[model samples]
Every structure is written in structure tokens, then in C-alpha cells.
Target: MSDAQFWEMNPTATEILNEVKARKIQEINAAYTAEAQPLIKEYPLVEQQSWTAQNTEARAYLAWHADQQGAAPGTPVLDNILMGRNGETGTETLQQLCLAVIENAEMFTQFQQLTGKRQRLVKAVRAAEAVEEIELISW
Candidate 1:
């Protein structure tokens, strides 16, 4: 509030200011709680980083393969490349490429599961009416 406004409401200004401060503090606490709650309790940061890195690397591989094949980057291209249907073998052997494809698919599935779980948890946190309720949510 401006100086003039504060002085004008002087009689109840202090009380109103204190109430606003309290509400602000509560809001800050709630935000902190929501963020501090880990999506995965064990090695949360490492797990999250691993998921992101794997997903990124897989996507990059797909894009690179797509560019090489002159087609769109997606599972179809990945399948064709792995199945030796593209006839454009580069370095890795068929077996090795197949294994990598399987690994990438598995990682993608895990990443999706993690993402869905985190989204649900965030929704629950936002729906919580109190900090205590938010605190109850876990990975």
C-alpha cells in the first residue's frame, strides 16, 4: 500500500498488513512443500536426470536415423532400421542395433511411466486443501 493509503487506514492498517503477510507466508510454504516432495524418494535427482538423458539420446538417435533414411523420425523408422529393412547399415551390427532398440523401447516405457506418475502426484498436490495433505503424497 502507498504511504497515503496506509495512513488513511491507520486504525486497522497494521492488522490488515499482518493478515496479508500471514497469507503470503502460507502460500510460500505450500509451494515449497509441493516442490520439495520428490517424485522418487531414492536418488531422485539422479533418477530424473537419467530418465531425461536416456529419453534425449533415444530421440536424437531417432532423428539421426530418420535424416539418414529421409523419412520422419518415429518408431516406424526405428523398427525398419533395426530390422535391416532399410538396407543402409552404418556401423553397428544387426544384433547390436536390435539390442539397442530393445533397450531404448524399455527406457521409453519407463520414462512414460515415471512421467505419468509425476503428473498424477502433481495433480494430487494441487488438489490438496492443506500442506499436511500434500505431504502425504509420495513416489
Candidate 2:
């Protein structure tokens, strides 16, 4: 059922539903920040060179591609070309070189585990899926 239908059917449970939704949003946000933000932040550093180098290299690549195509490098072509240079392969290539490097880096697994709060959240959410069930913890 749609959210509105559910709400209409169970107006009295609205407060509990809203609390669960709010908590889910908070949990997802926390997981994103903890697990994903740093990896995303490193994208520019890993994908492109420094500012000066980026500009110079991109311009050169554009000039070369334009010469070959006999037209100015359009935005899409520039993006593809730049991505190719970043990978030293076609735009659709898998296994970016940096990904392999990162995998081998001493910090990779630690970074992934620490940042991967979604795994933990998934387990918690799965357990909570049976809302009618009670869980007891032994200390």
C-alpha cells in the first residue's frame, strides 16, 4: 500500500511509523557519512591530476582528439577522452588502475569496514523487520 493508504488505515500508529521513518533516515545518513563520504572525496585526486596538470593535460587531449576528429572536442567526447586517459583504456573498461592500487593499499580493508556501516545497518534492519517479534539479549 501507498504511504497515504497506510496512514489512512492506521492513523493511530502514525507516531510510531513516523519515528521509525525518522530513525531510518538518520541511520542511512550516518552510514553514508561514515562509510562512503571519504571514498567519494578521493575521486578527484584519483581520477584527475592536480589543478594545473589537469588543465594542461585536458587541453592537450582535447587538441589531439579534435585534430583526429577534425572537430572541436565536445563535452561528451572530452569527458570520454579524459576518462580514458584516467584509465588508459576505453570509457567502458572495468578495473580502473587506481582501484587495484587502493585494493592493495594497507588501509583498504580497514577503510571499507569502518566506512561500511550499511552492512551493520542492514543486519539491524533485517532483525527489526519482524516488528512483532521480541528479542532478548543475555548479558
lDDT of 1: 0.54
Residue 40 displacement (Å), model 1: 15
Q: Put down candidate 2 lDDT per residue, 1-139, tens digits, no spaces.
A: 5567766766555454454544564666576666556555666654534433334444554455546666543344335545767676445422242233334343445665654565565455445533332122110
For all candidates, the clash counts are: 0, 1
Candidate 1, residue 95: the lDDT equals: 42
> Which ranges in model 1 have alpha carbons more than 4 Å from their true place?
1-91
lDDT of 1 by residue, 1-139 (tens): 6656756876464465454444444555555446545524544565455554444445665565555766444444445544565366556543455456557557556656555666676666556555556556665
Q: Pick the candidate with the highest lDDT.
A: 1
Q: Once superposed on the true structure, which residue ranges of model 2 sit more than 4 Å away at CA?
A: 1-6, 11-26, 33-35, 44-104, 115-117, 129-139
What is candidate 2's local distance difference test score? 0.48
TM-score list, all predictions: 0.34, 0.33
